[model samples]
Target chain A: MADVIKTATRDAYGKALVELGGINDKVVVLDADLAAATKTGMFKKAFPERFFDSGIAEGNMMGVAAGLATTGYTVFASTFAMFAAGRAYEQVRNSIAYPNLNVKIGATHAGISVGEDGASHQCCEDIALMRAIPNMVIINPADDVEARAAVLAAAEYVGPVYMRFGRLAVPRIFDEDYKFEWGKAVVLSEGADVTICATGLMVKEAIEAKELLAAEGISAEIINVHTIKPLDKETILASAAKTGAIVTAEEHSIIGGLGSAVAEAVCESGKGVPVVRLGVNDEFGRSGPAVELLHIYGLDAQNIVAKAKQAISLK
Target chain B: MDAVIRKQLKIKACKARMGIIEGVFNAKSGHPGGSLSCADILTYLYFNHMNVDPQNPKDENRDRFVLSKGHAAPALYSVLALRGYFPVEELKTLRKSDSMLQGHPSVKYTPGVDMSTGSLGQGISAACGMALGAKLGGKSFRVFTVLGDGEIQEGQVWEAAMYASAKGLDNLVAVVDNNGLQIDGKISEVNSPYPIPEKFRAFGWNVIEIDAHSFDEIDAAFNAAAEFKGKPSVIIANSVKGKGVSFMEDQVSWHGSAPNAEQYEQAMSELQQALAELEA
Candidate 1:
């Protein structure tokens, strides 16, 4: 822990937009008056000519991003997950995804970890909402390194993409040398006792859970699912088959995030494995400290360890 | 206004109406009233205004048009065909599942369609983006988008309005097709966006008011919009809900309804007579 440096994924996203802007002059950034909060203000400062704020209108922001995509520009529309995915879902689906435009939705402050902002700002359902739209690639980066890479990958890839960034500063899991794969999962640590799959802020927790499970003599195979949509079927199914028991953890709702994606994949593959999903169960988050919310919502290491054991017992 | 140019545009506008009638009658489902209401303006843009090449539909330098009231996609498809982007015969396949022309304008499928729009209040925002895109690249291409009078009730339209001005999108031109009727009833009754010109002006736009069906007014308004600098422009085109076809004109029943065989015949005959009179 002493050796590891932690950086907020949103910080990485803002920096990545700046770095990408310099690399690709056609990359345009649009924010919905949440530039300071979403961290797109950094890009605005760097390239005043390229950044345009669409006031507080998330719907219009998305529509404008779609329009910009028609020209030779790759547009990134940034806002809170609640507004970007929840408020402007139709605009994203119709204007961007329907046209399959090159507009990247950089949604920050996702999940209950959005903390003191309470139930209104926390967006646990963004993954599900984005997944339902056709031609939309959903990426939830686990840490700062992956978040930066995800931004570049989303830009280079032509089409609409939704990337979720966390507000909390989590321990950096991967170094700067790590490669980001689209629609691919990274198997952090392999073991046969049970498969512990997690995403976003929960990915690091899964690693800690692996250590906790190791102390209890349970060898948990940890998998970091960065790209939730297009599900990386091969990686997930193979891990499920190998482990025979699975547990999924995310800072989102248990209903329709990484857990749901993994469950559907395992079920569809005809591999009858026991899966225990660890997340907020059909409830809204309240105003609390960021870390307390994770623990209370069952989004921490102890819960992942507990769920991993439960999955193994069910199998 | 040059009488010869007006006569030629009238002929094209008549052909455009006939195509719209053919498309809706064939599809058995499409918005004919709004489509017909916009035919003259659509004709004016494609035939005489927009710098677009039929052979190069995706040409980045070409001026762009986004039909914000995209239920009027029939009119756009017709104008695109009249402009030789596709065959006029394909207008019959307007809303068929296999057709490239969609229920709404799809920028991906349709050859000359600039932006995809169906959900109301989105097209104008996209138009703003196009204007911003051109300004970013220091390009000369302009963007035009058409909106329904009723569609202005959407809060997003105003958001886009203020944004276009805030960003100083001078290359953008938006037309509110104030035919006075939405699907429900007259726009005045259905949450009025009336005094549309002053609203746009308040949003820092160069506002122009015109009779949408008149070629001279349409020409003058679009030309003024083009010449205006340092701010975006909005043309409030007062129009008949259903223009050209006598029975459907000003009739709210025709708002989203496609005409039956007899109605289609009468509409086409009326447009054919108008075309003949213009030629004579």
Candidate 2:
């Protein structure tokens, strides 16, 4: 029942970045010798002159991207999220985010979907780390359609932005004509029993959980929190107010990722709603099949549905 | 050097030194040793050598400078302020919150700052990127960066060195302040950065060894850097840790320590006499 939509989010990023390059001459693409892995190959194919392969030096690549961005170039530096957020955090904080350059960091290989590569490559902490930066705008789209829109949005937007994507194929939840807007949450479904706020690949799982809850005569509201930095506080609060209960989900740490963002919003709004967060609880991921990893990490729709049910019991 | 030009350069160097001292003494917390060590070099660049506009700091074709070792923010801030990038009074607010003069250089906050750099060994890479950017954009402007000898220990600095040489970054000039002390201890004890000129030469850079305190050698090094083509050049500026102050000379503890009230008065008096002597 959950196997409805399947498309590589990386494909969306590649296609969208190429389209963005065709229009904006300042939109340059830089890769850390992971062009093929991050699917920035299409950008390289079209704009060979504008594309920069900074070898395997992630730190140097980050500084180079920031430097290029300072010279009026809207640079989209793509690599594994692990390297972009983990390997070059200092550069991102000082050279890029501190100066507020218009550099888009398109980070793929997010979550356990980077299976068989082990925990070393899968960047589950990227969201929390990037969220800590002052001027960084974090974007984690739900699926391919949203991923394409997010990529295009990041290129057009100013300042430093980190757009995280997963390597595994996920459901295409958005339409072809879907447009991406910053700081706006896409309400996939509305309900009164419980509000399920999620980001990145977890948004798709939340949508499936909605169906599972609906079969049990529960109305679960699903909100796709694409922009986690300038979070849509109004929408989140409104859902929490009406639903009286909420559950936040993400493919990141339960500490400072989308779940934490939603919790902060709920706490600030003084809603005191029963908020349940579903994510990796201070644990590293292991190599396995995608579905098995999802279940093992308790991130499947079933787990989310259970969390949502528990939140309703408190409600 | 011509009589009039030499006199003017000496005056500018004195003014730069005065600015450095004033900003550091007022803040009561800043890197005075490194700032004083690089004052002559920064003075030579900002006042007489570099083609920059105080009115237009973002002029694309203007000469660029990245203080790779950005702990010397007081010196750079004073240079920028004295050059009319902002009000000279703002120099008093160094490292204070809400002030443009942060602990490190930031282009977003300060005028005349080409790039914000605090992390050592990273700014050279950024400078290399700027050089590459200039070539790609078909701009003929040259890019210059000043690094610390102690900062060269970071492996990324060598990576940038290799990158600049491989790309034939002739438009880039790197001035290394060969002051022997870092924060912990002397450069030799901390990590020997010996044969600095030869190392750069091996990496395909035209190396120039000069007495950093001598204005003549500083001038000649810039001229030599300009003459070289198809390769980056490094001016290995031999300097004392605290170049001007007698008590602070070659002192590692003075790397970031502010002078006490009594010491501040003495330091100020010394700088004032030095300025007066240069004028005389």
Candidate 3:
């Protein structure tokens, strides 16, 4: 078998920024002294004049992005998710979202997958936070191709975009030519028994859970949700309507991420399907390997397989 | 400054102060003390310093100003109205539903508002970002921001101060309206960010101190800020809270309170008298 190709979303994000810098002179990258971690260092190397290091000040960096956007520049402010969504929530809300500025927040190192750095570094509620803010477009890409495309798409769309990325190296799920449609969900498989809605690295894990369910003679439809805010409700509700059962999976808190979004959409549409959310519960993550932490947080394929059965039974 | 220009500025400043009293009095809710305090400074910028055209408020090359101390929207609205960005009559609808002039400076709704600012400690950072944007674009547009003395208590202001200096944003100028009083009490008692000039200087800015109401001093400081190269500038403009109206001046009680009918009449009467004196 050919070796499975893998890449961290942060790597794709960094490379995509360099691409934007080359094609668009208005593209400016701002980092809060985390260019090395968030992978914006690539853009800094390619366009030194366009890159700004805000020096351990995430709030200021966000405000700077808002300011730059006012003057006709497209700014991507890159930082760890904890700082971008948690430490500077008001800045993002008041400065960027309130005015609806052309500022794209590249928040890398989200969810429990940020291992060893533990709870303080990991942000499990960024989607909930970003979603609550008006005019914020949240996108959590599933793979290398999708992540790269999402960055370019966000640059093209003139508004506030909160793009979540991860540090863990996950398997590439899409082809090199996969085009990322804005606010659209990708249907990976078809089934009748249950629908598995997953996002971020969990999408790769959901693909594995589909095989696991298949081995047990259960047909599972897999949908990859990259954009969480504008949330392709049409795709999710159609799948829910078909299967009559849904299992939402993510590497984030189940309360306000993909699971909550799917459940909300399903409930609001009167689908009456049993939606089982498989994600980190209301608890802080611990120090461990990224893979081990996901497993411990019940964000792995085995958990999704088990949850798929639960959804099927609930139906 | 020329003698004729000083007289014109004084007359406009009085009109701006009257507008502040009118807006707050009508709204029955808004910050008047701080707004009145910075009236002269704002009048100076709009009437004399800034390279902005009311006819072309959205012109790409126009100078920018962020009201970092955004509760002072009455003062800004009055200045904008006086500058012909909007009708002066629109000031009556401030803080009302459907009014474009919100209680805070909203860039989206208000014309000539360079940046949306209400959340304190964030606007100066935005101003810094605008300045940085100009430098990158190789544009000559300058960015100005006004922060309240009490507002500097926010930790984010220091973060912006640090970044503004580090970036060498020569086009950025931040003025701390050192009005002394906040809603709670005196800034010193509330939380002293005293010796404000030292802080900016420590952050590597070109620091200038001036009496906030002095047009000559205000003009000189703005000129110095523009001429200075390789660093941002911070002008600590020492000013009186509720500067024009005698009953409200230096009175912390008037910080966030709207005057009652009697007080409104008296305040407007006082400002009208001042405007008449300036004209005379």
Please give the ranking of all candidate structures by TM-score, highest first, separated by commas.
3, 1, 2
lDDT of 3 by residue, B143-183 (tens): 99999999999999999999988888989999999989888
Candidate 3 ranges with C-alpha deviation above 4 Å: none
Cα deviation of A271 in candidate 3 (Å)? 2.6
Model 2 — interface RMS deviation? 1.1
Poorest 10 consecutive residues of model 3 chain B by lDDT?
Answer: B190-199
TM accuracy, model 2: 0.96
| Candidate 3 per-residue C-alpha lDDT over A1-315 given as tens digits, one digit per residue, 9 for 90 to 100 | 899888999999999999999999999999999999999999999999999999999999999999999999999999999999999999999999999999999999999989999999999999989999989999999988999999999999999999999999989989999988999999999998999999999998999999999999999999999999999999999998899999999888988888898889999997689999998999999899998998888888999999999999998
Model 3 / residue A14 / CA error / Å: 0.7
Q: Number of the top candidate by lDDT? A: 3
Clashing pairs in 3: none
- All candidates in order of DockQ, best leading: 3, 1, 2
Candidate 1 residue pairs in backbone clash: none
Model 2 Cα lDDT, one tens digit per residue, B205-276: 999999898888888899989889999999999998777777888999989987777887777788778778
lDDT of 3 at A12: 98
Worst lDDT run of 10 residues, candidate 3 chain A, spans: A263-272
TM-score of chain A of each: 0.99, 0.97, 0.99
